[model samples]
Target: MVTKTEETQLDRLENQVDNGGGGAWEYLCLIRKLKVRRSEKVLKHGLSILNDPKKRSSLGSEEWTLYEQVAIAAMDCQSLDVSKDCIRVLQKRFPESKRVGRLEAMLLEAKGSWAEAEKAYSSLLEDNPLDQVVLKRKVAIAKAQGDISGAIDCLNKYLETFMADHDAWRDLAEIYVSLQMYKQAAFCYEELILSQPTVPLYHLAYADVLYTLGGLENLQAAKKYYASTIDLTEGKNTRALLGICLCSSAIGQLAKGRIKDDKESSELQPLAVAALEKDYKQRAPEKLSLLTTALKSLKVSS
Candidate 1:
């Protein structure tokens, strides 16, 4: 696990490299380790090491990894010429490598050659049917080609085999949400929760979907999930707090008769309102009056 101190050191190394100091290899490795998207910086500093014979040789077998890194970074910055040079070096060394093949496909992708890229990725998948990266690249190709339905289909097929792939589930869920398919999105979130129950994000997302597909039962369920999020975050999540207030008020409205069991929602509303008021007072005093007015309006309507 990367510590806070390691992260601080990366920052310091970044500044050091920027000042024309050495440690180019250290800085580049740190950026890759942290998965930081300093694309321009990567291109600038990475080439510095690659261009110098001594520094390049110091990496030895790791020189290939640096080539891959610089290639991807160059593509990100649209410096295709540099990307091609780096990729050629890798291809010469690891000609039959699927990893290098992915780079070639990505270069095709960068040049808007969607058809060629798709073909390249498909060939890669044929050799290794369960290749997760290649599968995702296919989905990305569909998206880049403006084929939303195709992207959805690709993602669904990808999920059938890669059921444990939470990132794929998230992408599919967002696609469903974008198309206003709340129930489908809700199902995706449910899968995510089952896969990782302790993650507050899945709980919060499921709550939002249930709230969107609203009824008394859904609102009540949404409130419970929002409350769970507050508990998980130790009451620091402002949006989840607001969600609780909204769900409570909506439930209160739906249960107008204020039946015996429904009294909890009536009480819940006040607690959520108090939490909201306290949060706004501490975080954004300027917005407190507006929040109060909004709460009062909800009360009046109910």
Candidate 2:
């Protein structure tokens, strides 16, 4: 009584099973089809067949592949409980398989069981201590739980193991900046620049930290970095350039006050005026007027 369309659908479902014979992808596809058709009896049959040890011998070379497909499908469906059960079965069947621990941890994380997730990740790290992804995940978890010190400890451990990771160094620098440790952040940014001189964002971060530290001695250096950032980024960052000009004007004013030489102070006056005019054009008139007065005072003093 089935129509041609219904018959075709059933044929497609049957084809999903590897009669050649038996694999994880085949079983997973069959299960998905059964689930979609609401065939509870068939779905239960499939599950029972998967759980039976006697059927393993009959499953041939495709048994492990079928099992992995089932695990992945369960995870994709957000069926954490099912995924965990499948992973446990896999570990029991293949105790020496290296991916079981990772699968178990991923399922635990999906279920928001943080303590169990930590234990699983720690076990992985203990086995493979040099895995950067595992180390970064641990640091992220610590930071998520508001354990900044713990995150820093993890970062320090990672640094001790592998000192050349520019990404990790940038992450640590951002963390320090978040904590308002400007000087430490500046030092970290310096290290990052040494590792990756071409990354404009790192240069911008370095300039921001220098601006925060309130020292004009570094203003010229900050300006240079900001200019480099703008040039390398193809003039795409107007805000950074504007910030640099503002800071430069302020530093010029400070320099004029500090230096006793009239000629040197006079030289700073024109640079400060130019910076102020650029800032004014960028819609920062208040700071622009302030710098204009500073430039006028420098010219009169000279």
Candidate 3:
């Protein structure tokens, strides 16, 4: 007697558990389940597979990888006993593996053994000074322990070695922004823009940082980057269009205070105003308030 809503929910859960049918897909399902905090479902599906004698014996080398994934998910779910059992299986299978050793350190961190986790990470680094995984894990531990500066330092050191790691650069930039270190975050975005100029996100991000760290020069640069964003997105980027208007206003105000006859602002301000007004009129009637405000701020009467 399941209601339609209940049946739909069950179907979705089944789809997530099935997750497109493969070992790799199963791993992804476990990770996806962990992301949504569906720990009980993860335990139910994962243990059903691992507990079957035939399946457990047949997993072969993949057993260790499965155990590690399940162990981490179990730890997150507070199923410490299940996690411990999975970790023991992994430890027994790969006694000398540094990869398993990192998992051990992760378990310690999960158990709230911060000092021991740090020690284990340090010991691993001593064994091989260039282990990127261990370095990242140590940084994560530092962040979890509220050592913001320590985490930043560790990330900087890691980036020195892995300069082209875009994910690491993005993480570092976010950390810097959280600390209000706009210049450093801007540098990270600059590198991203240099590597992938066609990425509109990087251009927009760099423009935002420059606008936040305002000066005449920075505002001008922000305007240029915002223009690039608009062009890259085929002029459909409302935010970038607004950014152009705002930067033009800021520059005009600065010029009014310093130079009585500012040639650049005079040249750019009319063009910016015309573009914004045209877009504002073409947009949906419901969305005109924001564009109106931007136009008013720039003193563009329309």
Error of 2 at 55 (Å): 30
Per-model lDDT: 0.88, 0.68, 0.78
Per-residue CA lDDT of candidate 1, range 1-302, in tens? 35569889998998899998888889999989977889999999999899999988988999999999999999999999999999999989988999999999999999889989988998998999999999998999998898999999999999999999998998999999999999999999999989988788788999999999999888888988988888877777778888887886677678875755456655766677787788889989999989888878777323
On TM-score, the stronger of 2 and 3 is 3
Off by over 4 Å in 2: 1-100, 260-302
Q: TM-score winner among the candidates? A: 1
Per-residue lDDT of candidate 3, residues 1-302 (tens digit): 23346556555656756674435335435355444445566676678778887877787776666677778778778788898898888888779888888878888998899999989999999999999889888889889999999999999999999998776788888889899999999999998888778988789989999999999899989988988998788777777877887887887787665756357545655666666667877766666777677588576444
TM, every model: 0.85, 0.57, 0.72
Candidate 1 collision pairs: none
By summed lDDT, the worst window of 10 consecutive residues in model 2 runs over 36-45
